[model samples]
Target: MTSPEEALQQARATYEEHARTCRQCHFDAVPCPVSKHLLRAYNNARREQMRANSGVR
Candidate 1:
């Protein structure tokens, strides 16, 4: 298994890549409230994963 820090780094990298792709394709930055909601959901999930892996309980 990977360390928590490593996992967080990978997640950050993935989020950046996805955001970049969205910017290129949508060209509106946020595009729409619905899309923003989905992006926020993804960000929340990443945060949850980080907390789970950090062993802070």
Candidate 2:
């Protein structure tokens, strides 16, 4: 089972990768709000999955 911290870090890296591409696509324009939201959502999902798998109720 993956630790929550590891999962979260992985999620953050994914977000950062998207952010980089988004920034480039937009020419460093307005911040990528969607990417930020996605980051949080993914992290939350990972946490929930971890809890479910760990039988942590």
- Predictions: Cα RMSD each: 4.4, 4.6
Instruction: List where candidate 1 sits over 4 angstroms from the true fold.
Output: 23-26, 31-55
Query: Could you give candidate 1's per-residue lDDT for residues 1-57 as a string of tens digits?
Result: 865556656666666566667754367665555455555755766676768777555
> What are the lDDT scores of the predictions, listed in order?
0.62, 0.73
Which parts of model 2 have CA positions greater than 4 angstroms off? 1-31
- Whole-structure CA lDDT of model 2: 0.73
Estimate the TM-score for candidate 1. Answer: 0.48
Steric overlap count per candidate:
0, 0
Q: After superposition, how far is residue 12 of candidate 1 from its true place, in Å?
A: 0.2
Kindly list the per-residue Cα lDDT of model 2 for residues 1-57, writing each as its tens digit. Answer: 766667777777877777778854357655567876867867796877688778897
